[model samples]
Target: MTSYPMHTVDTAPAEARTPLTVLRETFGFVPGAAAVMANSPVLLNTFFSAFGHFRGGTFTPAERQVLLLSNAVANASEWAVAFHTLEALADGVAPEVVDAVRRGARPGDPRMAALSGLTVAFIEKRGHLGEADVKAFTAAGFGEGQLFEVVAGVAISAMANYTANVAGPPLEPAVEPHAWTAGTGAGA
Candidate 1:
């Protein structure tokens, strides 16, 4: 069977919408991705909006691109890694930077390298972090606030990553070309 139910928008089943409505409306059709997330659309919406906020406010356009795309690559999320990495490149991050992030490397930023390293550790350790990890991050110039931002980044991507895996949402029109290959280490 097809991964997602394919029907005319008007023909889809009625699903509950708790704030994912804005997203459903934004897309003009509710794919299984959103419908499944409707169980806790607030979680998904919060994740999406938070990512938007961070993209706009916390990190520089280039830095945000690096943190995000690299994280997605680390998680091996093909869909997210593809889109954000491209968005990063389109937003003026160097091709070399994009290339680095796509390969799940540190993109040559000490701060991002520290953050990404912590992120990989936290994920691999399932959140059991060492004092040295936090200290190393701070020593590298990431403050408590940066740590918070990193957590937010991880949370938001965790939502998208899980949703994408479960719903297997077809890549959005804007991101199809950047789609990830299965078992790739981009999101690992």
Candidate 2:
């Protein structure tokens, strides 16, 4: 197993310190994933930069969380599952919806279900969606451009999922209550 270092603002490499500080400020404490990622300045910066772009895109916070949660579930990332569950609810995704995602089921709300379903399929298909795949997403009221945005969201979340799963970051205190374990539905 790869052992990843969890760095804080003071301990992170020089290029990563500023972002670690920002993460500490934003989350009141830097998340374990960010802390582990801080060991690599390029990874830390690139992930956050992409995350920022994804956030600035058209998806609402709840929708964004849905995409993230779906990615976490698909990737079998327990840490991200816990974190995104909290973020989903904070962003106004219903408890049931988040729970459903954690359980690897599609969310109940039609729109959120569509979003989550599409995200899962995108990962499962490795981004090569057929016309029918595009139709299902668009029929759910997402624009064609938003399909591309969903890909962006998937990419952003996938990084966290892959990192946390590989590096095994300890859960942050705030996320302890929502801690998750990957089930049979998750990937390797």
Candidate 3:
């Protein structure tokens, strides 16, 4: 397998430096996946742009975490799974809900379940959702617009997840405790 550098702000390419710096300042450190993504300024910036839009979208922090975690599990990205696991817990998603998402099972909370279900379906089906998929998401109180927002979340996660899969960055310390193995999850 090919290896990629885990770049720091000082070591990243010129265009990637600014975003790495901002990420470091915001998170107190650059995440492992982002570090690897710094290999390409375009990839890093694109991920950051989509991430910014997703954060500004309609989902609550917990709901966003649910969708992100679902995407991670569905993509079978170990680094993403661990990162999203910690973020999900920190964002106040219930432990059981996080676990359920990690296991690729429906979450216990109605709203989270709906979010996770649609997100997993979105990924597993490659955006070719059935009518019931759309209805289930709407019935959970999410609007059609929010369904599109989930698309944004899935897209954002896809970039990160695919990056991690390809680069195989080491897990950051903060997320290490929540580390995952690809086939360990029930979904695998």
Highest-scoring model, TM-score: 3
lDDT per residue (tens digit) for residues 59-111 in model 1: 66776666667667667766667667657877787776676667656657677
Highest lDDT scorer: 3
Off by over 4 Å in 1: 1-40, 52-57, 185-188
Candidate 2: Cα lDDT at 6:
88
Candidate number with the higher lDDT (1 or 3) = 3
> Which order, best to worst by lDDT?
3, 2, 1
Q: Write the per-residue lDDT of candidate 2 for residues 64-152, one digit (tens) a residue.
A: 99899899989989889888887888899998888788888877788888899899999999988888878888898999999999989
The C-alpha stretches of model 3 lying farther than 4 A from their native spots are: 186-188
- Number of clashing pairs per prediction, in order: 10, 0, 0
Clashing pairs in 3: none
Error of 2 at 27 (Å): 0.9
- For each candidate in turn, the TM-score is 0.70, 0.94, 0.96
Instruction: Provide the lowest-lDDT 10-residue window in model 2.
Output: 179-188
